[model samples]
Target: MAAAAPALTRSRRPRLGALERRNLRWGLLFISPWLFGFLALSVFPILYTFFLSFTRYSGIRPPVIIGLTNYERIATDPLFWKSAYNTLFYTALAVPIGVLMAMILAVAMNQKLREVGIYRAILYLPSILPVFAISLIFIYLLNPAYGMVNALLGLAGLPSPNWLGDPTYARISLVLIAQLGAGQWALVFLAGLRGIPIELYESAEIDGAGAWTKFRRITLPLMTPVILYDIIIGLSLGLQVFTSAFILTGGGGGRGGGAGPDNALLTYVYYLYKQAFQFGQMGYAAALSVVLFVVSLVLAGAVFRWARGWVFYEAEDA
Candidate 1:
């Protein structure tokens, strides 16, 4: 057994051949730029932010050590709580709605129609446009008076409530605006839909399974993995939401420069930006960044853990 253990170790750590070593060196050389960028841009910044979280750096002056003061203040800060609430609310509503809309569009796009390609292109056009540009366009569209949306509502004899200006409807409007990007995710779903075996549907048909039954049993189960992917990506983007809100709220400047009316559009990342840039609270912003990083990690971990039960993998069953 002792002799076998040595043999096993040697087998596991077998020396690379000359060609293998040469290939490994070439691969490393090819990837050196990415490695350097990752270390300098990502890893160093993350470590520095963690360090700054414990200090009082205002971007102009040297960072002063302040222990847990910034974190402790976070617990008592009303704006912090409000931003957190707004972010959570937006994410909760937006992610599910976005996922569902993407799935619906994917289903529509997958239909065997003559003009399907044109429809798909039109649906996906919004996703290619710059988010800021889309936000600007939405600003005009969602205007309470004379806006196309409000004009249609008025024609229908419905109240044209202020969308971005009203606190009650501000976040909801953002949620609706988020759907414009659903076409991108729809493409992902369309790929998954295409990957589904036609044989499965044929077999279900032979077994006298209705279209709805086949969809519920086979289509949905097979699509679970794609749905899981969409959910995680949506969650991450929803948490980091800023551009739309910033542009819609006119650079987050209305009513005491609160992100929006009553800070309704004051998302967590926007608050972080205000701290780092607008208010010059770099250390506080660093602490906020750290907290956000931790929260994102936790949420992603939780989603992965929860997905184990529902995210069906065909290979696992096979």
Candidate 2:
């Protein structure tokens, strides 16, 4: 009976028509450009970088194999350690602060108003500006003596430190720069906020929940997935922080020699750029890139695992 059933199932299975086979071929042909790009631009470069990490190559000469030397050098380097620490500290401070600010702005923007679109546009404008332009504007704005930021602080009877120049304030200044671009994140959060059922808020109100209670019990719990997404995005961007730091620190001409005072602003990506371009250490740079890729992968996996408990889904409940 089992042998008969197997034969029956095989007889009943449908085979592809000639038209279907033609359609499949055309579909693959249509997407071949993307497939080629994926192989050539993405996959090939990644594999090549991994291969380069084990060899000495200064762009002009043929790569000479030197297994594990670059990795060993990275393990012992103080500047590498400093850059890693700075990158982590920046991500820790910036991601949470950026998430909180974006959430607040999103909640406020979610409210119904006569001219809400105007307010939203104004808020989102900064996020769309070129980073170089923004960095330059902030460089002048944060000038210690006569910049608008210092002048405003002085008016409030607060001392203003040299933002880009002082080692103590440089990273914090970068965090502030991150905040200025919160509009895009806020928009994502706003979409999440809208997706949340209004019935949840109404139910909380029926239970005599106040604003804080409703926010804690209803709003925040539902927003965890959005927060998780934002955190991941922030972490990826923050850990590879370069452009603003590079511009503000005067590119290759800063007090700490491409690093801000005392190497305080020398982020991981900036240090990698220095190694590969400035110092002609391509193999070492490739090792650093690989390390960064591994660390990011681990951090992302940890976050996803941790989120299993908190991130609620309507589909899961259904």
Candidate 3:
């Protein structure tokens, strides 16, 4: 009886006709371009870099096997430690601030303010500005002596800090530059805020929930999923932060010398860049990138695990 049932089950797994099978094959063939690109550009480079990490491979020379040397160098290097520290600080400061600002702006903009579309466009325009252009503009705005920042400060008789020129102010300058993109993040959060049913807020209002109570009990809880998404994105973007620092600090190799005046802006990716291109340490750069990936993975995993308790879902009752 068991053998007969097994035979019956085998026949019930409906097979595709020749035309269907042919179509499937053709579909795979059509997607071969994507598959090839993934393999070549993404997969292969990652694997090759992983292997390269254990060797001493300058850009022009063949990789010479040197087990653990690169990792050891990374561990012992003072500059590496400084860059990592600065990167973490930037991440800590920027992510939360950006998240909060985006949420606030989104909520305000959602309030049916006059010509709201115009406001949205104006706010979003900063996010789309070219990095170079923004950097150039910021260059003048933050000019230590003649810049608007200092000029405003000087009006109040406060000491002016060299933004790009001083170590203490350089990392903060980078963080400020990063917040320019917060509008884009704000837009994403705005969409999420809009996704929340107006009925929920109305119900809270009818129930005698004050504005703060409504926000605490209803809005924050419902917004968690979106917050988690933005948090991950901000974290990743924070880690991969390179271009702004690169353009601002003069590309880690130029007359600027170290990142800004005192290595304040040498984030992880920037360091990897300096290693690969500036020092021609391709293999080592690859290893550093892998370490960066692992760190991001751990951080993201932590956020995901923590999000579950805090994140609310409308389907909980369902």
Q: What are the clash counts of all predictions, listed in order?
A: 0, 0, 0
Question: Can you write out model 3's per-residue Cα lDDT over 1-318, one digit (the tens) per residue?
Answer: 223222333566767768768988999999999999999998998888889999999978789989988999888888788788888989999999999999998888878789889878888999999877888788888998779989999999999998988876888988898888888877888888788889999988899999889888877888888888899999988888888788887674443225777788788888888888878888788789889878999999999998888887677643
Per-residue alpha-carbon lDDT of candidate 1 for residues 105-182, written as tens digits (9 for 90 to 100): 888887788898887888888888899998999899998876899999899999989998888699998898888888
Least lDDT summed over 10 consecutive residues: which range in candidate 2? 1-10
Ranking by TM-score: 1, 2, 3
User: Which pairs of residues clash in candidate 3, taking residues 3 or more apart in a chain or in different chains?
Assistant: none
Model 2 Cα lDDT, one tens digit per residue, 210-291: 9999888888988998999998888889888999888888787543335987788899999999989988889889999989
lDDT of 3 at 275: 84
Once model 2 is optimally superposed onto the true structure by TM-score, how far is the C-alpha of residue 317 displaced, in angstroms?
A: 11
How would you order the candidates by lDDT, starting with the best? 1, 2, 3
The C-alpha stretches of model 3 lying farther than 4 A from their native spots are: 1-23, 156-159, 252-257, 316-318
* Candidate 3 displacement at residue 48 in angstroms: 0.6
TM-score of each: 0.93, 0.91, 0.89
Q: Quick one: best TM-score, which candidate? A: 1
- Cα-based lDDT at residue 139, candidate 2: 88
Candidate 3 residue-wise lDDT at 85: 88
Output the TM-score of candidate 3. Answer: 0.89
